[model samples]
Target chain A: MRAVDARVRALESILVEKGYVDPAALDEIIETYQHRVGPRNGAHVVARAWTDPAYAERLAADATAAVAELGYGGRGGEHLAAVFNSAREHHLVVCTLCSCYPWPVLGLPPVWYKSPAYRSRAVLEPRAVLAEFGTVLDDDVAVRVHDSTSELRYLVVPQRPAGTDDWPADALAAIVSRDSMIGTRLVSV
Target chain B: MFDEPWQASAFALAVALQDRGVLDRRDFAVALGGELESGHDYWDAWLAALEQLLAEHGLTNPGSLDERTAAWRRAAAATPHGSPVTLDADPQRLRHP
Candidate 1:
């Protein structure tokens, strides 16, 4: 195993040396994939939850099963779970150990999700981080921080914003940004 | 630096997959050594190589891969840190009503 790992590393070095990738460009691609895909998936899931109470129940009970029901259970979605956010209690998600995410549901996790600042500070001072993201919880609201591990991943289901009453599920989904699902931002009115 | 962007992506994917323990390091090293024009092409090629490796090693048998990935997902879902917040149970539950 060690020998194999070494070889893989060496080959990667060669690829870098050969100029196949600019370390920076690769970073950008990964970032784009994360941003574009993550929020879209979150919006879809949020829309489904809003339109179908039964689906929301299933998602809360078992995310993976519920997602599979939608035919979105492949690739990074093998292990999916949802943490529904309500008015009284708020939930925030962070990956402290590594960037373990529900890629199937949210595509890729944003770079900030995996940063040391996010991982460390999210658990230690979640309110501050959320504040930075422009999410302000009332003093009475208790903030709960969830740390994602390699095996378990999480997505926040934001409380349905007001004035979205007549909108169709698809329309409602448009406002469910990735940041909102991460507990960093709230769904706009 | 290489002309093709895919090659670089391929290299990045290889490293990412290896880091994630999705592919065997030995095979990745062997396949990568064979050569390509640029880093951009690396990701596409690496994925093809990985799929081939999976088939060659008989790792593609009868939903086994899906089952393994499912297990990984289950493990991730079972994590206790994140749970749904119920309005009634939460002391801070928003009382807009």
Candidate 2:
């Protein structure tokens, strides 16, 4: 372990000694959040919104409560704000302050989301950012950028694909890519 | 991240502190933002922010972070190679809540 690593280890040992945290419970927490928290939690929310107008209304009104109803709660999901996409406008999520992401809903943020390049450019040129992700929107549509903070994080709900009218909510969720929820990619087929 | 053992340890330490209300989430974000503005490496800043709050909250004692860190350096050097390093207060731990 390097110096910083050693320091961190010392810190953890100290914290454990102080009884502030239990080693077993910390292991469980790490197990719960490592890599991706399935990333499907947000997909379920999106699919439910698409198939049920009433649920969608509740989501738009109280993003946090709606997410908790689905049994997910933590940092980013605690004070969430969902932004729904539409024919006239688009929404993209970024955190200029830091890599504050909706971890409970979308799992750990992708590496690019934490990169300074994406942080600066996403707000400066969202359309270009989206295009770089291979999502080309119509010229007349407006692109909206949502910056995340510790107090509130935003999730983009991409419009349901055109041919998915007959698809079940589970099927719709299966097609909801992580990037779509992050607003970097649009769902298709 | 798995490639670096400390990365996960650093992350876990921060989470545990925050979970116990020893570190404030909003305050932590502000510290991170400041570190980023100063051009520190992302992970360095994350570690620094946690260290900052840890020190402020007296988890390692306010002015003793440097001392404790240096102590670890000594401990690691004294421990035989291929064996896990143990602090002077090893296993017994140093405090009671």
i-RMSD values for every candidate model: 16.4, 1.9
- Candidate 2 per-residue lDDT, tens place, A81-165, comes to 9999999989999999888998888987777888888999999989899899999999998999999999899989999999889
State the C-alpha lDDT per candidate.
0.63, 0.82
Put down candidate 1 lDDT per residue, B1-97, tens digits, no spaces: 2234444454455545555555665565345323222231333444456545545655443254433333333433443457531223323223421
Q: Give the runs in model 2 whose Cα sits over 4 Å from its true position.
A: B1-3, B61-63, B70-84, B88-97
DockQ of 1: 0.03
Q: After superposition, how far is residue A49 of candidate 1 from its true place, in Å?
A: 0.4
lDDT of 2 by residue, B1-97 (tens): 3347677777777777677787888999898888877888777888888877766766667445655666677677777788888776333235421
Give the per-residue Cα lDDT of candidate 2 at B85: 81
Clashes of 2: 0
Judged by whole-model lDDT over C-alpha atoms, candidate 1 comes out at: 0.63
